[model samples]
Target: MKLSRHSDYALRIMIQLATSGDALVSIRRIAETYGISHTHLMKIVQSLGRAGFIETVRGRHGGLRLARPAQDISLGALVRHTEGEDGLVDCAGCLIAPACGLPSILAEALEAFLKVLDSYRLSDIASRGRMLRALFDISVPTNP
Candidate 1:
């Protein structure tokens, strides 16, 4: 299943912050590092912030950081937050909507997909902290 670019960016931002530890990361730097639009990334960041995944600090010295530990952030939870409750198919307009089994089958597929994601925390996916930091030119936590 393909996730929206918005969800994709949110996950990337989370991973970046997870690897940074307590360090505040600038949105501009993250955008540049990922070759993504700053404006686009800003919107994703705002959504993640609203969902309580990340915290925004205001001030000249302020930036963004994870609101909680990486281990507490589940991939399935993040996907749900970003994707909302929209169904995979719009059977409302289909002629066979009343008896079609496609919707139920698709729903089962989605459930299985999310079940796999639910098994992993951000910590599991962000295990390559040093590698990610090096690729982004950010300093890796010596103690991590």
Candidate 2:
């Protein structure tokens, strides 16, 4: 199944936050880094915040961070939140809607796909924190 741009951005946002450690990341920074629209990224950020995936801080020094640890955030759950309950095929108005076996087949395929994602957590993908930070041009904090 193809993922929406919204889901794609959401995953990117999660990865950014995961790689940042405890630092708060701004929407503008993320938008610029990904070369995506700032306005569009804000909407996605709001959706992720509402879904409890990330937390949004207000006022000066404000930005975004994960609501919980990366290890606790499941990839399948994030995709589900962003993808919604819509099925792969919209057979509602089709003449073969009632007779088609394609819907069931697609549903099974989707389930299998999601099951694979379920096996991974955000931490699993964001394990290369140092490399990700460097790639994003984010400064790595010094240990003192």
Q: What is the C-alpha lDDT of each candidate?
A: 0.91, 0.93
- Give the 10-residue window scoring lowest on summed lDDT in candidate 2: 135-144
List model 2 lDDT by residue over 6-110, tens digit each.
999999999999998789999999999999999999999999999999999998899999999999999999999999978898998999988889999999999
Q: Write the per-residue lDDT of candidate 1 for residues 1-144, one digit (tens) a residue.
A: 899988889999999999888899999889988899999998999989999999999889899999999999999999999998777988988999988899999999999999999999999988988898888788766776
- Where's the lowest-lDDT run of ten residues in candidate 1? 135-144
TM-score of 2: 0.96
What is the lDDT, from 0 to 100, of the residue 139 in candidate 1?
A: 71
TM-score of each: 0.96, 0.96
lDDT of 1 at 143: 72
Whole-structure CA lDDT of model 1:
0.91
Clashing pairs in 2: none
